[model samples]
Target: MAADDLPDEVPADPALSASADPAPSIELLAGPLEIVDRITIASNATFVGRIGETEVVYKPIMGEQPLWDFPDGDLGHREAAAYLVSEAFGWDIVPRTWLRDGPLGVGMVQLWQDVDPAQDAVDIKPVAAVPGEGWRLVFEGYDDRDRPVALVHEDSAELRRMAVFDVVVNNADRKGGHILEMPGGHRHGIDHGLTFHEDHKLRTVLWGWAGEPLLPDELARIEAVRQDLDAALGETLTAYITVTELVALADRCEHLLQSAAFPHPRGRTPATPYPLF
Candidate 1:
C-alpha cells in the first residue's frame, strides 16, 4: 500500500491511559477477552480485541502456519521473549507482550499501541534523490511499473536505540510496518515472533547506523544487559526458548560490546526482508 493510503491512526484506549502504574493494564490482559476485529494479512491468525476495557493484539499458537526456517508453534513465546529483552534494557521498544491462554488456545497478547499518523519515520518515499538530512538510503529498487525507487528511513535517536536492541535479539524480520510512532514522538516496535534464534539472523530496515561507533549511553545499556543476563534475563527467557538460545543471546551482547559498532549484514541471508514494509 502507498504510504498515503495507510489507515488512520487508532487513538490510545482511555482505559490504559488512566493509570501510570501498569498493574491495571496487566490485569486487563489477563481478564476475560473478546475479539473486536480480525487482522487478515498476518501469516498467523491475529486479532484486535478488548480485555476488559483495554485494547490488545492476540496471536494464537493454533493459528500459526509452519515455517521451514523456524520451529513450529513457538512464535508466540518468541514474541514474549522480545518483550522481556526490551524490559531488561529499559528500552521499551517492544510493546507489553505476554503469554496467556486465549479462547483459541495458548498465545501471545500485547497491548495495542496507537501510532501518530502525521509521522512517516518508519516508512516513507522520497520525491527525488534520497533526502540529504535525517534519512538513510537502505537500497535502490524498482516499483511495480518498472520505475526506479530508493528505500530510506528516518535517522532519529529512537530508531537508533531500536537498531541496537534488534542486534542483541537477532531479530530476523524487522519490517518497516513493525515500527510504531506514538503520539508524543515515542516509537514502539512490535511483531517480534521471528527473533531470538540461536543463529545470527538480524534482517532489518534500520541499517542507517551500521558501522557507526556506539554512543556512550548505548554502550552502557549493552553492559547492563550483559550483567543482568544470567540473573534476570536468563531465567525469564528459559521458560520460552532453549538454554542454547539464551547462551547465544549473552554471546551477542558480549560480541557487540567488544566490537562497539553497528554490524554490517553477514551475507548468509538477505540483509533486508522480502517486503521492505
Candidate 2:
C-alpha cells in the first residue's frame, strides 16, 4: 500500500488534450432511430452494435452500487481516465472515447472493437457466476485485406508479459472476458477503472507471468517511468486521482524496477474488472 508501486502520473499533451466542446454530436446506427433520453445504466445495459461501427451500450446513470468500493454507474469518469492513459501509453488496446451528450444526457462515446473470428467461440459457461461475473472470450483471426495477425495469445509468452503489465497497474479486473482477441493476432485490453489504487491491490487473470522475470525492455520501461513519476505524466494522473493515489502508482513502478522477478500480490486471484458497457 506504500506510494511506490504505481506508474508515474502522465500529463496530457497539448496535441492530445481533451476537446474544447464538452458536448459532441451524437448519431445512431439505424437511420432515424429515436435517441432515447435520460436512460439509466443498470446490469441490463445491452450492446447494440458491432465492433467496427458504433456500438451503443445503454445503462442508467442513476444508481448507488459499489464495485471494488468505487461508485457504480460512474462510467463517464472511468471512460475519460481510460482514454487518457491509453493514449499516453500508446497502447493498441482499448477503444477511443470522447465525452458527449447522449440519450442519457452527457456521457461517453467510444469506438467499438469486434471479437476475433479465428479461435473457436469461448465457452463462457465456466466462469459465468464468479464474484465479478459475466465474461466471454474473443477469437484470434478474421479474413480481410487490412487485418494483421494477433500479437498475444491467451497462454503465450507475450500474454504472460502482459500479465506483469496488469500487475504493475494494480488492475483489479482482468477476467478472461476483458481480454479481446482481434482479427489479426492483435490482443487488446479494456476497462481500466480500478487502476492507480492508493493501496497496491494488484489483481488480474493474466497471472500467467506472476512469478516470471521482466524482459530487458520491460525493465527499461519501468525505470524510465520512475524518472517521469514527478514529471508531466505523473502530474496529469493527479488531476483524476488523489495525490496519495498518484504516489501509490509511482511506488508500483519503483517496486517493479527494484525486483528482478515479479512480486506476488496479496489476495485471491483477480478477475477482469467490468467495463461500463
> What tens-digit string does per-residue lDDT give for candidate 2 at 1-277?
1112112332222222344222222223211222333324333232332222345433323322455555545544454455555444444455565433334343334545677766421222222222222222332333255443221224554455456556556666655566667776666666565565666566555543455688786776666655665786666555455677667767887778778567765655433333311
| lDDT of candidate 2 at residue 175, scale 0 to 100 | 58
- Give me the candidate number with maximum lDDT: 1
What TM-score does each of the candidates earn?
A: 0.89, 0.63
On TM-score, the candidate that comes out on top is 1
lDDT of 1 by residue, 240-271 (tens): 77888889999999999999999999867888
Candidate 1's TM-score reads 0.89
Give lDDT per model, in order: 0.81, 0.49
RMSD per prediction, one decimal? 8.2, 11.5
Native-referenced Cα lDDT, model 1: 0.81
